[model samples]
Target: MARNAGKRTSTKLVFLLSCAGLLGAALIADFLWASSSSHSHAYASIASNWVLEKSGTVVVPNKEKAEAVKSKNNSVDARILSGTFADLPGPELKWEKMAPAPVPRLDGSAVQIKNLLYVFAGYGTIDYVHSHVDIYNFSDNKWVGKLDMPKEMAHSHLGMVTDGRYVYVVSGQYGPQCRGPTSRTFVLDTETKQWQRMPPLPVPRYAPATQLWKGRLHVMGGSKEDRHEPALDHWSIAVEDGKALEKEWRTEIPIPRGGPHRACIVADDRLMVIGGQEGDFMPKPGSPIFKCSRRHEVVYSDVYMLDDEMKWKTLPPMPKPNSHIEFAWILVNNSILISGGTTEKNPITKKMILVGEVLRFDLNTMKWSVYGRMPYRIKTTLAGFWDGWLYFTSGQRDRGPENPQPRKVVGEMWRTKIHL
Candidate 1:
């Protein structure tokens, strides 16, 4: 009886020890799994793994697929063909509606100073040229009426830049009718709400590309008086005390192919010229002012960069021939984000077909990629970036194929949080 009791005690002790060991192993496995899951979520959030599929759609892979790609050779093509590219979840670009403007406007010049956005002259209802200056308070997110521009300064297609305290308004058209270009320039002190006329541009032009770089105003290609002849001329002038100096403008290397409504941005101390149209507004044949035999217009996809030495170098052309002149662009994360331009015009209808696609160009790789498409077609809008967000003001929308003048003006305002 004593031997049987001792045997039973030993058996019970063995069972307890085995149970403890299994529990300890299970706890370690759970801890490791939790840590790995947290790390994966963090990595997926920061990585640029979202790709545009060949079907003109954007796809974001799930965590399982993302991890699988990371574990393999990391070839995007291979992962895409692995039969897991359908409906995978990922980060997406989000757009939010903002306060609308008081009136619908287009082709205006916009500049930001601190928490204020100053919108200059633009075309309003019935194509009426507006001289009123509409100010938007970033804090309040509302439009506040301000002083009107001088009667002479009331024009659209103007170029504008700001130095945080003052805004410099450059050349644009004058009066309601699309008549001729104006060399007039003006400066406004935001604090005083006062306006002062500055030295005029050397040549009369409208829709010129202007930038304030290193205390100087760099003016690039624009259209001449006829609107048909695009100028290849580039000039720079010294700006002092919120006024352009009396010194003559210095001429730089001319653009290879001058374009009207071109976009110029200062990136990494280099001036980049985006898409523009070569021949626009050329008078049709049998008109009183027909100067050239060729009246057809050509939109260019070519890009050029200007360095500090005043040398011009050509860069790779964009994938698509985008030429919606006077479009808006913003620089984010060392990449240029261009939105709402025209890819081409209808050959027979002569109507401008808006390019609904959004594109991004990486400065590091010198490559262009399609980011996504806008919810609706937008063109000739004023865009600016503030507080890591992009604001797009009033612009024109496509009125479909039935309308004669298919471009319909709108007063919608939109904003989006920029992630890349």
Candidate 2:
């Protein structure tokens, strides 16, 4: 049990402030906010993995194994999502709908410590964001409990990473959309479930790349306080047991391109960063309403790797431009798999485009491949690998395949076995 468990820093003022300003949402932002969805889907069952035949057509062992499961009841059952080329022997992917999250989340962060998956604070709406943390038991396949963050904790776009026992959450936007970023950082002890304030970031950032590497907590690129400029500064702090050993952060090699909403991972002793965007919907300088510029969104497929010499190097770009994929990655057989996110936008309309392909990046071969596709496109999803199954939950689902637009933020928990 935690030492001081029931105590909470009151966030009522800010929450109300956000709601009070809700009607002041920018035109682009108002257009982006999606209403709830009641869409239902039918899924099939998978027999075996996929194999690419000599004719270059991907085929699965069993194709006609269809299973009828109703998602209306939020049943925790398995469903199959196969390839679109029904005539051809397309790849078959298996997925399960576990219990939905306690609340809809986006722009938040999640970390897995053993079997317990901890979901942090995030936006439930442009005017509303949750300040509590939800815990999901992987073995039990349900939400077991919830914990409230410190009153000072940021509400969304949080940069988070876990060192197995202690999860570090760095700077992020503390209020509603375009309110501003924070320099405050916190760490949660999984054993005690106690969140203790850590050293504040030298500069505040929005959805920065956070990772634990070689006895140090490395914090890198995100956006600045204004939400328009990128924070290219890279800083690290020496620490042990979730406490900073040094007084302040030490300057490190900055990333070539600075941006937020990037996936940061430290695998096999090397640091890697994948798909992210540079600039995004920013509030006009003097407008009381955070008037957004939908046309300014510039999503990218940039991938960067930190070499052993403490120098930054470039890697092969992704198959297409992707962003908003934070926490949507899982490691499988030495390859990094990114599930769903936003891809390129429409050239003429400038509307945000969603992604459905499961991108697999071979760390050994330094190559990228499309493992399969998700039944629907999503962004800001959380991912975890347990019992040999790839589980991801909580994201904004796309409207539909024919008109794949960003829909409402959902609590749907979906899991699939990696066919690769």
Candidate 3:
């Protein structure tokens, strides 16, 4: 009986030790697995490895889509693009109207900092151009005044982009109203509300499309001195140590074809420029009116795409030959939302054709389609994307007889939502 008890005790001890060893190994394996999983997940989140991950999608809300998702309350939201259109009545996209700017100004540049939009330098009322800066709060829905610009620039185009703080104003035309093609660059610090002069462009170009990409700002395809003469000159400015220096100015790829002096967005490292008047807007005799034939008008629907190698590839053209002063916003993956501008003749006409057509371009698919028009017609307007919608303010209709000096501005505000 003693021998049997000893054997049983030894057998129990062996089993317990075996079980403990197994448990220890399992715990260690689990610990290693957890550590490896954490590392893999973190890397996957930041690396943008589409192959190792599923493709994400965006659905813009429209009449059809909005109704489809109405039951599922959290899935869709309806919004509107307001203001005016040549043919459309009322607001196009059911948008919330905001407070107008203190004074209406056209061709003014806007940059968003800290979720706030800042407007600066353009043609103001009284037929006199001033360097005024207006700050608008989206959350509060009001326009507040800031300090004046350091120099007065009249009849100028502001090529603007922001690093989320400092707004970089690139090569634009500015001078006296009559002789306003001076090559100038300015930088504004949104935090301090300060403006400083930066290095000027090699040549004077107005309404040039400027964009920031690959740590450099590219200024390309603008008018040299006259509106009729377009510059194929492409220049890149490097921002270093918080100043625009001349040594940093290097020429890159010239535009394949001369485009109007309007900047479009650089989406997916691809740069595009939209419409501007191809022929010169020469002053007519006996009248202050400018006349030009549309025969020489090289209306561009061809959207050019610039690659990292600085080579140009023509994407599908814009849906229409509409190019007053259009702006582009990144709607979603491989798609851009473009809106506003004029669809009139190059020199314009007694009856201005204000374009409210909002179109979307799919970069991946190379297709173009119309969305909706603004409630009102706007030309020479400054537009940028903020939050989740398209925000455009401070524009002017076609040159009216009341304001023949070309400084009439608009006070209305509009927004467009892309349901995706």
Maximum-TM-score candidate: 2
**Candidate 1 accuracy as lDDT:** 0.68
Cα TM-score per model: 0.72, 0.77, 0.68
1 versus 3: better TM-score goes to: 1
Can you tell me which runs of candidate 3 are displaced by over 4 Å?
A: 1-91, 152-155, 175-178, 245-248, 280-298, 326-334, 344-352, 398-408
**Candidate 3: tens digits of C-alpha lDDT, residues 1-420:** 999999999999999999999999999999999899678655533322111122211122234445555656633432421112233322357666677777777566666666577777666642355577778777766776676776643345656777777777766655423244667777777767777777777877766777777778778776666655767888887775356645657988788766454546767666777555554342234433232121234445556778777788777776666554633343455677665665533121122344555667777877887766655445666565666667778766533222211224676677766575
| Candidate 1 total steric clashes | 0
Q: Per-residue lDDT of 375-419 in model 1, one digit per residue for the tens? A: 455666677677877777776665432221225566777877777
TM-score, cand. 3 vs. native: 0.68
Top-down TM-score ranking:
2, 1, 3
lDDT of each: 0.68, 0.75, 0.59
Pairs that collide in candidate 1 are none
| Candidate 2 residue-wise lDDT, 152-223, digit = tens | 989888989898999899999887656778999998888888989888999889999999999999999988
- Per lDDT, the best of the predicted structures is 2
lDDT of 1 at 125: 41
Which candidate, 1 or 2, has the higher TM-score? 2
